[model samples]
Target chain A: MRGFPSDEELMKRCKSGDLSAFELLVLRYKDEVMNFIYHVIGDYHRAEDLCQETFIKVFENAGNYRPRERFRSWLFTIAVNLCRNELRYRARHKAASLEDLLQADPLSERFLIDRADTPDMICEKKEREEIVRRAIESLPESQRMALVLREYDSLRYDEIASALGCSVSAVKSLIHRARQNLRKVLLKAGLGEGYNAGI
Target chain B: MPGYRLKCEEVREELSAYLDGEVPIWKRGLIRWHLMRCRDCAAEAFELRMVSRALRAWGDVTAPRSVVENVMRAVRLRRRKMEEERARLIARILRIAAPVAAGVIALLWITLLPAFYLSYERGKVRPLRDELVTVRVIPQSELEQLVEGRMF
Candidate 1:
């Protein structure tokens, strides 16, 4: 009805009882949404569940979708809200350590190894990466969220602000502070100078 | 004015933004003037630049393929189950409403019409019964005898 129906078109059909359209929407966004959630929650299993739940909400609430907003942004809004809820729940329950967050899966190990420039480099890089990741994980929730959205997702400052419901300046400050903290951690690990040289 | 002296602490504070190229032009000039004279500030800026470079390199690190696949699979299953639930709910509501509408229509046709007809028939039968009772109470012969006595 309105300019051919991008995702909104499919979603409008979905609201009018088009099951196939809804399925198509799900197929299109599932991976992107899953990846975002995985990085946000820092746990594969939980992120998996949250990703499923996100789609379920999208499907059930399809009727509530307004054409004025980008479908992806709205969908991600639902996801970011869910992630915030999950993070809050985790905090209430007790914080999960970096060791707990790291996947012991052989696949992860293999993935790291494959990316290595050499066998010795792989081990050294892996150790450094682990330390850096831990430093990131140790960041305050807001800073971690800001860095992840910007660094991993490549979201712009405004998008990060929108996702986190903060001011643009606040997002910038968060990322800057996160980078500073990471630098400190790497410096302490004796990898800072080496990492700098390699970079 | 005395020659400007840029403190190491002040230069270090601006070094992060300098490395990011976010330093304003005026600040950049001041930082350059300071760096030209201050080795410590110069070294600090270099170190900050290196740190940024390392972080940029860290971006190359990626999650495993299997992890990605596993997450995708889980997401797919979740969506499928939700779609099924939505369909089931719509079907259930339709099922309930369809029978309710049919039952209302059948009740009007099979029960309401007959009951209305029977009520009309009772109305006619009541008037007839009153007429029959009046006739039985006063016969034609009694009426004729009253007229003949009057005449005599």
Candidate 2:
């Protein structure tokens, strides 16, 4: 694993005019970046758009990359900024309930643990997941982003702080406050054994 | 902050870090003690854990196949557009320059031909005129005397 060209190496190759290396870089980070932005913006389609734009910017501006910086953080910096822009756009346009919009996609069988569980229980679980999803969506941008990066990407506090252009303590406070907000939102929508089922 | 019975607000503050295992060992112990007895704070911790779990379970969202294709497509499209613009600009310059060059050549020919013709006609008469000047011209009287003297 150590012998393989790291992301920075690939980026350097990309800087020297290797499209294949850039493509490799894209393949490496695409899903992670997509999911990060997806959680941030709450719309998968728009997340995909922003994810493409992020890579495009990276590809075009590979020359600007400084090797001292971590590529993942640098990449997320671009991603989170784009997410912010989309969020601003959504706010102005009064978009609502991204889970509702994207919920049309059928839950794969993996979400169902046991066939023995009654369909009613399954529906109840899905309903609770949706509520949790909406509660997450309702968080303020910075808080929501911190929570997403921390939980989904599993980035360290300092790394997340780097990505978000904030201090580590600020990142911690953001996630903490975000949890408090989530608790309020979730409990208000009714949290009990069902919402906490899978966990 | 050590060796103190933890307040619920303090536990709330530490929940995210505690869930992440970022809390110090002693602080974690403090949080453990707090959650053991406090139902509200414990429930909050449980819910936050659930949230983290749900997002983690999202796994890879797996961007549609078109995303990668679209990125490369856009790159190619921009390159093509620039190539077309460069070609169009060259054509535009040629369009302007070709007529101007032809006009200059035509003007030069139209102006120089008459000058060349006049020069050629001048060359034909120049030596004749010079000869007439070099020879001494005799008036008609001198010519008649010469002819009368011939009778003598």
Top-scoring candidate (TM-score): 2
True contacts kept of 1: 0.09
Model 1: which docking level applies? incorrect
TM-score of each: 0.59, 0.68
How well does model 2 score by local distance difference test?
0.80
TM-score of chain B, candidates 1 onward in order: 0.48, 0.41
Candidate 2 per-residue lDDT, tens place, A1-199, comes to 5567899999889887677888788888888888798777756677788989999989877889999999999999999889888889888998765545655444323343357879887776666556766777778889999988987787888889999999988998999888778767766776644447646
Interface RMSD measured for model 1: 4.9
Give the poorly placed runs of model 2, Cα more than 4 Å off: A1-3, A96-100, A103-122, A195-199, B1-11, B24-44, B54-60, B79-152
Pairs in clash, predicted candidate 1: none
RMSD of 2: 12.7
Model 2 docking tier (incorrect/acceptable/medium/high): acceptable
